[model samples]
Target: MQPISRRTVLAGASALVAGPALARADRWARVVAAARRYDQLHAILVAHRGRTVVAEAFRGDGLDAPANVKSVSKSIVALLLGAAIDRGVVPSVEARLAEVAPRLIPTDAEPQVYELTLQDLVTLRAGLERTSGSNYGAWIASDNWVADALSRPFVAEPGGRMLYSTGSFHVLGAALAEASGRDLLTLTRDWLGDPLGIQVPPWTRDPQGYYMGGNQMALSPRAMLRIGNLMRRGGRWQDARILPRAWVEACLTPVTTSPYSGLGYGYGWFVTQTSAGRLGLARGYGGQIIAVAPDAEAVVAITSDPTQPARSGGYFGDLLSLIAEEVLAAT
Candidate 1:
């Protein structure tokens, strides 16, 4: 037998790394084929074990182009809340909303407002009458979004029912700013974007200068995948624990059940059961999704324009399930 040469040794090491790469490429080809078959997908990205298993941007968009994540912004806000809690700058979620935003409370406040807690907002059990559906556009366009949100009549007792409210999330953003004595965008940038190497654009701000917390945030598909991967890894990135493990667990637990889809909502994430198993995801309008399947050790992020009348189903959900069934199963 011929003795092994240095070149042969280097070739063997390269193949070891290339082995996974080639396998991933094959898996991605299937995902791309599925996306093409579906017809509305603009982008799809998949990651496993913190590695990019597949990334493809269809429909002429590049990876760097920012796509509006709509409600995925809510999950990012939840992370900010966790970071604030971990730093001891804010007290527990039990803290009264009146204590955090005294201005929003009427001087002769209703008893329900006094009883409301930060936890209520996070859990979507705030009991305020929600303007979350058709009225959202007008509500967001109002001159005083926070005040307008607060003006909504109370439908039930505080913490009594699960009412999906974008207004509630906006209030949470305001509360965080009040408790930490910093603007929401600055705090988010310093605590999250800078640390994670994410480039969050200057998001639309309310008339009061608070970042629009409930919706209309932009992120690259890769950034969305990164956030999902972080959640999959239990709030740690590589060696650093960026968020509290306990808090992350709490974020994944179901706090309220969704009337629209029957899935459960926790903090900002959505908990649902798939054919494969239980999973957590952040879904946004127009088919943007950040799906984390912990059992499969996979995260898939997709951005697409599903609002088009021709393509008006849950394409993101369908595409993700297919990827889980086909590509992930192969691995």
Candidate 2:
């Protein structure tokens, strides 16, 4: 065999290191080009193997500007519940609503409402009439949000099919507040924002002064990316164990299925089987998404116009296709 020159050896080693980096750059460039097609999108951030590889802002808000995350707040709230459990603020998922926040229950609430558990509320299986969609205005307009949610007639048995009610989560926030002797914002800041090193700006509050649970929270795209990365890392950040690994794993396990998109509903995430991996998505109104693909060790955060709808048949579907085809494929 011929002896190789020192210059030749150095060139070969450099190529070996640069090859994957160049490929990643090429793939993300394609992703950015495809993302521009959607006028609603504000930003897209992707992190691979625990480091940010791509961050782009196309319009509207800048990548670091806080934008309304809408129902993605529900996912964050769910994490708070897990943290509460870990801290012994609340007992466990099996704890009954009436047991924890008995005063919040309305006088006329159905008998089954008292039996509703933490798991039921987090999973949207509380069986209460939905306070989302067309009924949202009236529910929010009510004199007392927590009472209104509990007083709603039972549309199904507790722990039945998913009802997709924001009211359930609102009631949950109230209960957590009552149980912990701390408000939702305080809990969020202490448990999540401080740990993840992200800002948690105050959002909408109900008539009784409880922070809205399932909607209207604000976080920058970068903040959302940190959250996704925390989840991707099994609820840890650096040296700190921000969330229990078991709790994070539980959040990934399917507890129910969403009726709207046919995706499995975990603690606060929507579960889906994709070619790249088992995707756990924290979705919101408009096109906001924080997707964690554990199999690929990839986390993607997307923010869009909060005022517009991103239904399954429209813009949201396009976002999913973009993640699966370009983002995950690159991983």
Clashes of each: 0, 0
Compared with the true structure, all predictions reach lDDT values of 0.78, 0.92
Query: How would you encode candidate 2's per-residue C-alpha lDDT over 1-331 as one tens digit per residue?
Result: 9999999999999999999889889998998999988999989999999988889999877999899999999999999999999989888999999888899888887888889999999999998899999999999999999899888888888898999989988988889999999999999999999888899999999988999989999999999999998998999898899999898888888989988999899898898889987999999999999999999999999999988999988999999999999899988
Q: Tens digits of per-residue lDDT for model 1 on 180-261?
A: 8888888878887776778888788898898887788888888888788888888887778788888877888887787766
lDDT for 327 (candidate 2): 93
Per-model TM values vs. the true structure: 0.87, 0.97
Residue pairs of candidate 1 with colliding backbone atoms: none
Candidate 2 runs further than 4 Å off: 1-5
Cα lDDT for residue 51, candidate 1: 80
